[model samples]
Target: MTDQSTVHSVTYDLLRTLKLTTVFGNPGSTEQTFLQDFPEDFSYVLALQEASVIAMADAFAQVTGRPALVNVHSSAGMGNAVGNLVAASHANTPLIVTSGQQHRELVIGEPYLGNREATTLPKPWVKWSYEPARAEDVPEAFMRAYAEALQPPAGPVYLSIPMDDWNRPLSGFDRVRTVSHRVAPDPQRLRGFADRISASRRPALVFGPEVDRSGGWDAAIALAEKLSARVYGAPLPDRAAFPEDHRLFGGPLGMSVKTISDRLAGHDLVVVIGAEVFRYYPYVPGDYLPDGTALLQITGDPAAAAAARVGDSLLGDPGLAIELLLDLVAEGSTRTAPEPMARPRELPQTPNSPLTPPEVYAALSRVRPADAVIVNESTSTMAQQLEWLPTTRTGSFFATASGGIGWGTPAAVGVALGDRDRGVVRPVVGLIGDGSFQYSVQAIWTAAQHDLPIVYVVMRNHEYSILKSFAVLEQTPGVPGLDLPGLDIASVARGFGCRAVEVKSGEDLEREFTAALSAGTTTVIVVPTQPQKAML
Candidate 1:
């Protein structure tokens, strides 16, 4: 049969046309047909586990701003892939996740590898999920998945193809199409919103990851400066949208409703752009807004806009909306600019004493490359990381939007791969907590195999410190399984074929970290940090 006559050939052509030439996967017996005679131009990134497979694809897509292709085994692999799938969804990373299924003919008989309920497996996490009803429809299904995945509020999508369908004959292929990824805001509505900003005596601007993702960083800065407004990074943002070192930057918004509301108490107007009206965890119940404060939000996510507890939300592209707001709002305001947030106190290195989280971050920050990309999962010390290692550029920072732990390790691998792919190879540093590192530690092997330059700094506090903080907050004392006694993180990294070491002093860390940054191979630096009380 001619190249275009078979389902496999046409599908490969479609993927090539869409520039999804790299595939992340963990192979299984059911996927063999699809792998038969894999094209020379395509690269397959193999991760030891499906969770790692999904996370790597997630960060790769995030950094490259393209829909990444992922292939996993049947039902079992899909189940293994769910945690990172949820993270990818919340982060709005566009991933086209596919799985091999039992042969179409064998599926009816309930074969061992069949994913009978494939469409429902990745539910709520995926934007769309489907199993091709016929062999000829596989390519078309993929095309639809691409569109769904790249659309505004972009997220992961899934498709299931029977193992035997790859070679099925097809008469022709469908014409490829382009989909617009941005949705413009309503001009009149934006104008009305701009009027409110102009009228307010005190205004506050809250920026979120979407601002950075949509290239609105400069616009956000302009808007804040125009109004002499305080700029707060959205709480728990997956990406840094504003330069943290800017004088106007007011630090991150609080994670709780009361905290956020209280922080903005004196502001007459609060404009949250490119994020949810709010994302709250550990429920600290209070008024959604402080007295005499008016809140408004601009976001591309309809669901985020709709789900907001209190706020008038404008649905559209946050970047586009902010650009429009800049023109409509007054050129300048007479109101006094709000004071910048207080900087964290500098903690100097103490010899022989266990290193504090701040000291570790301070050491790394001192030598951090200007273009470095940080994949942070050091949960207990996140505030400290933010304080010490500021993100001043777009796409310089990444964390799980879903508050999930495991995504960081594999995601660092993906970020390095993305940077390499785009020819702007930034140093990738993964600041992962010991508890978090264990979740998908296997992913580092992929980096070793690919010879990517990535430095993984494991903050070994030897416990789930964040959970313990929650226990304190909830008044639930004596929580079992809160502490992790013995985990030799360096040994674990060695097993994964990475150059590994354990360092306890700041001096040692700075030396090893600087060396690892230029190591030209994946390196894991495990630091035994003194445990500190966690803060929300």
Candidate 2:
């Protein structure tokens, strides 16, 4: 048992109250004092790199629907973790990220590991960042960090603690406080919003990552059905907010404004929920909406609302807003529900010589468990993956919201662990590209060590196919460094203590993937796939 008199003990007590017993980290010399005599009840998830640390914690927080604690070394470690921190912020994953600082007495002299500009380093990306003014304030700082990380538009928060502070005597104990996570929409505004939807002849609903993040799948479907609306997944969504197979469900929206406006042109009213007004790219020059259409957006993020180019914005918890709209909006309306967008025809089930991405995804879909979770970073083959392997369950799909590669591979590890801890364990399937896999390849060690049931399929296309697609889109020929030759992901996984294999044909992929699904330990299946240009 820890002594309650020390700052460490008191802080741990508060963590226990908050049920944040799972800590993800990579240790360093400066953090040793704080980690001394670690509590037996806490689970310490170790990652080989700080980048993987943040990604793992981000997925854990996303899976368990709770803020996750992350411990890193110092400034150098924080610098390494910044890339994934951007992903976590875009994903809006609530993370309490703490890093150790140099000894208080030596900090003034600029010791070797002192975090110069500690609070400024992780700025803009983090919701809040701070270092305790006094050693006694360390516990209080942590408490405040927890609150800030869990508030609306939840994102990662940072805290820097001096290595010497953990052993400092506690002046007194601080009481733990409960904080509300959701903000309800204004009653008057919501009533008007519902009225607008009810009056629309052809209404459309566009769902985003937040719908799935906020556990609003059922509410979203109900709201859509009540309005007899066509439902489309938001543009470039990081999570699957609707079941692709649902009759009312349309395919994902395009990333460019022109494409989106064209797709929703027929609809008289479009209601975008739980996402930014629009996440556009490639400078698609066009009107934000069609001539006969009106747009309304409900989002938890005020910034998203404010930055929206064309929309009547409402600030509230998107899920709750949808639920409330169900009550206010007229039901059993005579408006004709639009036909669902045509789904891609299923490819031939026969195995191929050099497997295609669609073929691989189809084979996996055939053998994949219904409840399995998919974390994908195979950017070039995303459209194929979504078509062949539809996500039917809530909270079953994860990807990087920042359009960054490398987060998915490590994220799958955390998803499996989080699912296991939450008592709803499901098989985790990682569809990772060869280039994306290499970004944080060391993460496989953490999964292997934990023996998480994750099947990592390395889609080896021997090049950065996504970049080549971009080159194609921009008409930029002869781009250098697009090819990624001589990468053996299977060999790397083996070195990391995972069950690894190389599959050449679709039959072998299906066979190995089926076996890996039931395997107790993590498996890496490296299958060489035909390169395909990505469609933006």
For 1-536, candidate 1 gives per-residue lDDT tens digits of 45446888888889999999999999999898888889899999999999999999999998888999999999999999999999999988999999999988788899888897889999999999999888989999999999999999999999989999999987767678999999999888888999999998888899998999898988988888988899998988899999998999998888888888888889888999989878898789888899999998999999999999987989899899988988899855578877777895677645536788988888898889898889999888988888989999889999998888899999999999998889887899999999999999999999999998999999888889999899988899998998988798899899989999988888899999999988889999999988867767
lDDT of each: 0.90, 0.90
Residue 281 shift from truth in candidate 2, angstroms: 1.8
- In lDDT terms, how accurate is model 1? 0.90
Tell me the RMSD of model 1 versus the true structure.
1.3
Report the alpha-carbon TM-score of model 2 versus the true structure: 0.98
Which pairs of residues have clashing backbones in candidate 1? none
Per-residue accuracy of model 2 over 501-522 as CA lDDT, tens digit each: 9998777888999899888999
